[model samples]
Target: MADDRRLEVLSAIVTDYVRTREPVGSRALVERYRLGVSPATIRNDMAALEDEGYIHQPHTSAGRVPTEKGYRLFVDEVARIRPLSAPERAAISALLTGAVDLEQVVLRTVRVLAQLTGQLAVVEYPSLRLTSLRHLELVALAPARLLMVIITDTGRVEQRTITLMGDRPDPGDDGAHGVIDPVALERLKIRLNASLVGRRADDVAPALAGLAEQAPSDERALLAAVTGELIAALRPDAEERIAVAGTANLARATPDFTTMGPLLDAIEEQVVLLRLLSGDPADASGMRVSIGSENHEDALAEASVVTAGYGPGVGDAVAHLGIIGPTRMDYPATMAAVRAVARYLSRFLAGPQD
Candidate 1:
């Protein structure tokens, strides 16, 4: 019975400390929670919890705050993470309703998520290597410039611009009329799409090579020129990127001038921020909650990360989305928001292309 009451006391302390951002006293716990106990019993429970290292006093005369271990226990056992309310779901849906394309959807999602979570939201762009090509478009914008648009089955659209030598003549033309021919462009689009559709980014170059080799005399050079640009655009190293928003939220939440530099610096570094999210192929459907020092990044030692994986395909495919905030944040609420946003993103990606 004593152990049960002590755990209850510890839970109250953690909850109050997270909400108030101050060490909670026995009297405060008694006033805030109906624990059905006397103030003397609550004080004794607080003393026992402090002795066991679950809660610690910040100063000689102050009350107690929960340690990382205490927060972990509260998160894993005591705290109940509830789902988003109907109004929140409607708000999220209303915010994301009219995005024009997948890129716009991904771009808006991070910002909407940041607003929803009230933390720095980061979302990794879906991996090109893992997605199959759905379509490809090439349009000549100038005598020598062409825009190439690549669309993938996972609703990701990537684009690149290429240049052709203006002085070169068509292979079948008798004159050096270097300007692009619309008829030739249409033929190239059809030829490229036949080979590229359903092919992954990594396998695209070889497929392009095979198609170019089997091409007719007048089309080989055009095919090779277009394929070169497509190969470069499809390189995973060149196109790997992420979306981030809500830096102002971090600035607003931070009060200590000493922590401002490292925290803001971590948010600005793309590689550092990308490594902070734990979702990948293996953790495609799981969540990673790294609290304080658990993140292993020295700058992030004073913060916590709540990441959840979101899938864009029907199979075992996914990308990561989550937020960063102070270690004393409300875990259950933040985790629930992250999870709800991830679910919404998955539905959007799985639904339709546009």
Candidate 2:
């Protein structure tokens, strides 16, 4: 266990350093924190902290900065999330309430987070397996060509077209388009339901055998298109992660041009960003904050992330929400806003009209 006074002093140093983006020294800490101890005593404690690898000096004579271990300890032991002010809360409510559709909600969420944190923000679309099948529509374009559309419980849409080849052209139905009888449409609906209903779209292969047995001539082509669309729609593309707002804010930090350029490139790499934010919730509820070097990626060494998991009302897939920002970010305010935003999203998506 860390000593109470020592932890207090360490927390103070971290908070101050994060705010100023400068190393914090014993004299400055004593002056600012009123630790009821002499500067020499604080210096000794600082030395001990450095020895324990919680803090380090950027140069021999420079003040100390928190190491990854230092940041982890501070977040786990001393961080306090402040609630948002009334005006801020009102602003958030207005932004969320104006969302006309699901896409708008997500896009607005990303923008709000970036605006608040001044760092890169990201919110991944919910995974497909968690979404229940709401509706499926099939339209016959010709005797053999068909178009299929599937809508999920989350309002995500997937569409595809299938083409079938036949040995004979049936030109009897008013032209060469052939016949699309009610029987064929009913059969197609049954095949779609069998393959997709109540099952994760990814697990529909075994069900395809039944479709093949009944519609052997066109089954393969139809299955291919349907399966392709389902997978494509459900999965997040590698490029999607980098599509974010607020890269300009990162420039305000005191990073050298070389460091800044690479950092920007790294942020544009969606795979790395997803991997960084991909951890499961640490506790049962509420929010989790990772500060500075506590992050796994070296590119995020100077940054911090605050995240949480939410769901849609009684039962739904856990939705991850949070902000990524410089370590100096206003934690209490950010955490409160993030929590509020997440709860609003849950309610908004679960409302009767949505």
Candidate 3:
């Protein structure tokens, strides 16, 4: 019973401090919250909480503020995540409307999340190796050049320009450019669609090689060029990239954080950003919070990260999205906003049926 009362006092202290941005005294707590206790009892609870490292007196003042431990406890045991209202959900879905492709969807998602959370938002693109091919378009440009468009089921599009290394074709498209044989292009398209349309990008060279071996001699060179470019697009990204928005919000909230410069720099570094944003449902909470020193990067020691993974289906994460802000943030509201935005983004990327 005593422990529960202490927890209630701790929760009240955290709430008041987060709201008023001031240290909470026992007198303030009794006045602001219905603790059902006298000032003496509240002060005793505060002393016990401070002794347990949950709350601390900043400068010999009687008023106390929650420590990181206190905030973690509040999140884990006390605070209830506020649900996104119907109007808020409608607004997020509306923001992502008319995005023609997955990349556009992700871009708009970051923007919406930034606006919603009022913090720096970052999103990782899904891995190309994990997505199956949806469509491949090979267009002959000029006599010796071909344009390759690779589309994935995840709505990512990759384009590459390849110059056919060995093929020599006459300029025949109305004197505009030498067009590869229409018959050859169509046959290659059929072969590629059959071999690639529903397959993951892994071990793709062998499949394309088999096609090249069986190609008619006249189309062999063009097929090889097309195959090579497609393979390049399929290779895993050497450096993972992320889209970021609302950096201006960081500067605006700088006063709340002591490590603002390093935090900003960390946000800009691809490797650092990836390390911070990457989370799995197996290892992280549904809506995870990495607060203060919980962030592995030293530069972000005074910052907090809120992240959730979104994918093509339930619980299978294809990508991660989240916000970064000071540890003194309103945790429940931010978590709700991140989760809500992620749900809409997953629907957008999951295609019409999702």
Backbone steric clashes in candidate 2, count: 1
Off by over 4 Å in 1: 1-7, 36-48, 165-181, 256-258, 279-285, 314-317, 352-354
- Encode model 1's per-residue lDDT on 226-276: one tens digit a residue: 888777777766656799999888887775224778888878888777778
Compared with the true structure, all predictions reach lDDT values of 0.78, 0.66, 0.80
Tell me, what's the RMSD of every candidate? 3.6, 4.5, 4.0
C-alpha-based local distance difference test score of model 2:
0.66
lDDT of 3 by residue, 172-218 (tens): 32222234666677778888889878888785777888887677666
Model 2, 98-170: lDDT tens per residue? Answer: 6776677878877877777666667765445556666778788876677777666655555667555443543
The best-first sequence of candidates by TM-score reads: 3, 1, 2
Lowest summed lDDT over 10 consecutive residues: which window, candidate 3?
169-178
Best by lDDT: 3
Lowest lDDT sum, 10 consecutive residues, model 1, at: 278-287
Error of 3 at 184 (Å): 2.4
lDDT of 1 at 351: 76
Candidate 3 colliding pairs, count: 0
Candidate 3 whole-model C-alpha lDDT, 0 to 1: 0.80
